[model samples]
Target: MRDWLIQLRKERKLTQQQIAEGAHIDRAYYAQIESGTRNPSMAVASQIASFLNINTFLFFPEHLSEPFTTALRNSPIIVAHCDLELRYTWMFNPHPDFNTDVIIGKRDDELDHNEGTIGLMKIKRKVIETKKPIRQYVSFPLSDGLITYDVFAQPIYNDGNQLIGVATVSTELLT
Candidate 1:
């Protein structure tokens, strides 16, 4: 839960104080929530969700999908898709062509072990574990320097609730 909040704040390029102020909550309270020391009440959650213009259930992403995909894609940030192993699934930027060597194919490597894809890989597991989406990814540089990505994802499952894969997005934050 705390991880999700932190990710969401960072993805929005916002800070705890900012969200707390905007959501009309105490900064200390929000910090506790982000630090895993507290949980927001239903009313507080609703207020925060409304202020963020995000669906309230976003706190738990089993509640995310088709209805939110459009909203998520239209976000100023990039959006993407990936298999459970964290391979380079697909992206939505419309700029970085997948056919280019800039990306890879199935069975390329675990995202965490890959040079540019590590951070994304790390967070993907969190999404899978929590069955929720995260917003921010700890950005790290690859050996190539300019090829790094800051990514996050929403885990997708089947009607049977079987873990399918993830829908992701990222940006070359360093560039």
Candidate 2:
């Protein structure tokens, strides 16, 4: 979501400040939306989408299949999916330490800017670029200390067999 917004905004050679101004929103507030800290309301989403010259539906994951959504919801593992741009489109049962509400519409880099995050981002990139599945151990810092998980990521394809995104499941958390 944010990735698409950012990409579209960049394609138009617009800055966050500019878009914010055009949308009649505070730059700081707009930054929050771009950072996935806060979600925009439908009206706000519409406004932003219009300002960016993109469809508002891009902000929603309505295109995802119901069976996939159900699988994610029913999975006990922390399941998530991100577009080819690495922006999260869907997530379920995220880490307890994270705010699930803020996970969607975020890029891997937006979530954190640490070495751990960078490593994870690299792995995600590889999965997308190679169109392969990967299973690895990942550790990231938490407020208390650190947590680790076994992460499995695979590329997602549409009906035409075109890669669209990456799906991941992270479980077996170790503190």
Q: RMSD of model 2, in Å? A: 7.9
| Cα displacement (Å) at residue 32, model 1 | 58
Measured with C-alpha atoms, the lDDT of residue 28 in candidate 2 is: 91
Report residue 36 deviation for candidate 2 (angstroms): 20
- Looking at model 1, the pairs that clash are 80-168
**Once superposed on the true structure, which residue ranges of model 2 sit more than 4 Å away at CA?**
1-76
lDDT of 2: 0.73
At residue 36, give the lDDT of candidate 1: 68
- After superposition on all C-alphas, the RMSD of every candidate to the true structure, in Å, is 15.8, 7.9
Candidate 1, residues 1-175, lDDT tens digits: the string is: 4555675577568999999999999999989877868767778877787565443454443345766666655444566555566644344442332331233223324223454445556688789789897877454444444454556678877569887668776765545
Report clashes for each candidate as comma-separated counts: 1, 0
